[model samples]
Target chain A: MTEASVRRVESLGASELLALYEQMCLIRRTEQAAHDLFMSGMVKGTTHLAAGHEAIAVGASAALRPDDYVFATYRGHHHAIARGATPEECLAELMSKATGLCRGKGGSMHLTKASTGMLGSYAIVGSHLPMATGAAWSARLRKTEQVAVAFFGDGATNIGAFHEALNLAAVWRLPVLFVCENNFYMEYTPIAEVTAVPNPAADRAAAHGLPGIVIDGNDVAEVHDTVARAAAQARSGDGPTVIEARTYRHFGHSRTDPAKYRPADEVERWMARDPLSVARQRLESLGVSADELQQADAHAAGVVEAAVDAAKNAPEADPAEAFTDVWADGGSTWRT
Target chain B: MADVITYRDAVADGIAREMRRDPSVVCIGEDIGAAGGVFKTTVGLLDEFGPERVRDTPISEQAIVGAAMGAAMTGVRPIAEIMFSDFLACCWDYLANEIPKVRYMTGGQVTVPLVIRTANGGGLGFGAQHSQAVENWAFAVPGLKIAAPSTPADVVGLMAAAVRSDDPVVFFEHKGLFASKGEPAPPDHVLEFGQAGIVREGTDVTVVALASTVATALAAADRLAEKDISAEVIDLRCLIPLDVRTVLTSLERTSRLVVVEENPYQGGWGGTLVSIVADEGFDLLDAPVKRIAGACVPLPFADALEDRVIPTADAIVDQIRTLVAY
Candidate 1:
């Protein structure tokens, strides 16, 4: 990391640091509960958890305004939670309950809460990049200062839509932020096996004629400070910025994956740099007491427990509701 | 209040009218600006809407459709052009998987008012890569509304309706019909999606066709008059909202059905139309339905081979005569 960037990270106040730590804790706790639910067979289907990469979601989303839009990938529970989606609503949607966001139509991978500006989450890798770019174009046409953020993985940067979206955004000077959370692995394959470059941000941004910033994603202060600057630049009509956060995922790609492909030493190393623990250490060094940190952890645990309870009790979605929402005209007589 | 205009101008006029009517309407495609598009359908859109609204994009169909889908969800009506229908294969994932399922997947929380305009069909000698009648591929997708307008008037009306539609509309303009001139549609004319236009009403046999095939069917109807066959030609403006009522009504009078399409015979849209009739209006039929379509092979570049592959007016007339004889 550059000395200048490190100095900027140190500029964050104590309360902001505490808030970042609290959000990271909440995400870690919620994802653990989700993993437990999946293992217990309470949650059907596969889920990609973002336990080790919480700081990127929490920090980058904290930089945007409440009205600004966020387009996230399938591993998106953290993105939604960081953007102010209630834990109960997110868990219920994962559980396929009617009261959940998207009314249970989109479960786990496709969580959407328009009220919080968390536009739909996509499962297809790098596909949502163009949509996010389009959203930025819409903002430009409407003359709004709103910035659109696309949260994708390192794997997505290699996809055709990623390059196309970035090129379009750069050419049109659209207000969009491309955030690639480099989780070191694309499912089970190491990124180096597929991608030619060690870091995609600088080369890609240079190709598109935009500023590219890379930071230690495990550091919440660095992630927040860098994203906030990029968001401000986008809002000021300086076109898009590519931000690559170097991070890792503690769990396997999905519920069924055991991540045996990963080396044991590599897992230990990433686990040591866990974003939650990293933030907690930062808070401790900033004169926060251990008791206060423990209390915050307990609070996050309580929130996750309550969310799980609510999701378990929520009613199953109605079978007839499937026919609805297929068309906006509601003239579809296929059901009738 | 109607003037004569080419099919290209009719498409341009429809898009320009929608842009002027709604401020949120924007056009995004390759060479659609100063170059006026490959087919010149977006000839004057760049000057009228400026670059902000009429955007010339890179050769990226996935991004173009994805951007339009994203913009549509955010209250901006985007009319994205894919240059050629064959190029849709490059971004079929976005069209088949993403764009069509957004509204339904979101439980109607968001509506994609997106129009994907592309030139389809063969006959221009653009070869296999350029010329293709692949509307059937898009027709198979559930949520998409597919439109294939035959004349300038129908093109204008369908284009306007597609722009105003809340669902994703795939507007297919035939390459062979671009130069064809016809009466312009009225300023406020927006053809309802599920309604079919009966170009020539008759009683012996009902010939259901779409886009360029509609012209072929109309010519066949005229030749059938000489033979006293009295063929009915139904111009299916859009395929998604298949106008079964009109086809069924025509079938009630004419018990024989002959479906024609520019695509191949196997798994083509003609098959779907034939299946619908066979399943629902079986008792009304006097004979087995005949489907006249392109040969089941890649469209060759040679004119003689292409002519042999595509169904001509004479073929349609012969098919009708056989169905009428039955």
Candidate 2:
């Protein structure tokens, strides 16, 4: 999908467009810092950065309420930030500090903050699909007008949980939106190389009786509009819908890989359509001043700097926390 | 009031009572509604409560558990049944990941008050595919609570308790105990979690058992008595929230421990019990903790092979003899 074919969902004023650009820039700067820390051995463990895929997170998160639940894959830094988590809390989690969202136990892959309705992010491939469906189902049963959105890669469409969750959501008419960020590659393998089905991952939803849509992922406006419609459909109890966003991950799958599987030319082609630049241009065309855009960029850089400082200063996790949250109070008597 | 009832009836009655007490309580499983469950534990639940409450689902273990997690999170207390414990492997992601971690992941924004009841253990000649005890799998999961009851009274109490819990609980019912008859204690009798029930009290050695092993332990305790050895038998009501205190207390008096379980020896709950005793109560132990677990072999389809794979009273008595002599 080309950027020219992408249609803006909602026309944002100059201020709103600038805010969106700033948010996307903030995600990029924060994740870039993480990549540097990971390279320097300061931050440990595998991190699936959201640097290349900030537009989807920023645009989609803008369409939902804070009370609605959101589930994401391992690549979830942007999702947490866009869902209103402070960059400090998210960075602290990546740094394995005590004040992290999971109290340092979950690290990068399992970071979660239920207070902000970021239900949780899972490292397991398609595991959280059913979980989001269950949460959405719960909301409907309780008469809550909340919706559940699960963000996964194209690779997840082949997993059993994806199919099961979609079918269950359709049969029960549950309030769920399955967003497939078809980033072209499952780690080293491309979706076209792995998936036998010719259509987009969203097309698979039609078999489950839910409407499906394909959109240009690099276009923030398109992602925002498509997800807004899907979220609305879910909140209205119109069952589930699948939105396939054709995007790309510029970096390697994990910290270790440099994405040798993709040709350099393809990566360069995707970099030209960088999501943050597109959002910035949209705002500029709508009469936003160059000074205003620069101010947003500087402020976003400041947020990133503050987050890094806070994460570095955060305390270490107490060894005793290994025993907590296993169950509710009086839930288990296994001694420390 | 005391009444004679089968283990299945006692459990069914517990479900009926809980449904009547809570308007949001519901049941979902295969053949549970119109078919009344394969073993008839829910024989008339659909008739007593409408299909809305006692629901029969398709033969999808993943869906059964996933939907129950969804329903429970929304305020409905769901009692989901997997036809056999062996089938648990198919839907393990839902049980181990989603159901248990939902509340913690949601930061207490929601609660998964769900119960997954499945029959386990061998003796029905159902073979390896249908007759494996998978309670150990549940024991490994963090946020999941596991319980296995031996007597009709404990069955009723524990089933009710499992539903009342806000955490995800995996309740394992022994297939062999379904026909075992016992006196039903009062319907209001509630057996708390992490508390062991001393079925037969003695002082020579403490025999720690759970589920079907309780009966074998009792029989072994009787045999030990004839041999002039007093044996204290304690039934572990809940496995995960294990009654470590009861075991410690029993060992303080009895001075020896023997854990009998239906699962294989390696990575089994019995191993966990032994580790606990060795780690915490080493100074008080008169002898090493002995474990009489199922043979480390795939449960055979043949009756003779299956019998050999499971622990019997003879196996328990033999292990106790070794522990006592030591």
Report the lDDT of model 2 for residue A269: 90
- Which candidate number has the best TM-score? 1
Which runs of model 2 end up more than 4 angstroms from their true locations?
A: A1-14, A330-332, B23-25, B43-55, B67-77, B94-112, B223-229, B279-289, B318-326
Candidate 2 per-residue lDDT over residues B127-169, each given as its tens digit: 8789888788888887788889998888889988888887788
lDDT of 1 by residue, B1-326 (tens): 54689999989999998999999999999999999999999999999989889999999999899999889988799999999999999989888888888777766778899999999999989898888899899988888989999988888888889999988999999999999999988878889887898999999899999999998998888888987888889988888888888898899999999999998887798787878888899999999899999998898999988999998999998877777777
- DockQ for the candidate 1 complex? 0.64
Clashing pairs in 1: none
Kindly report which residue pairs in candidate 2 clash with one another.
none
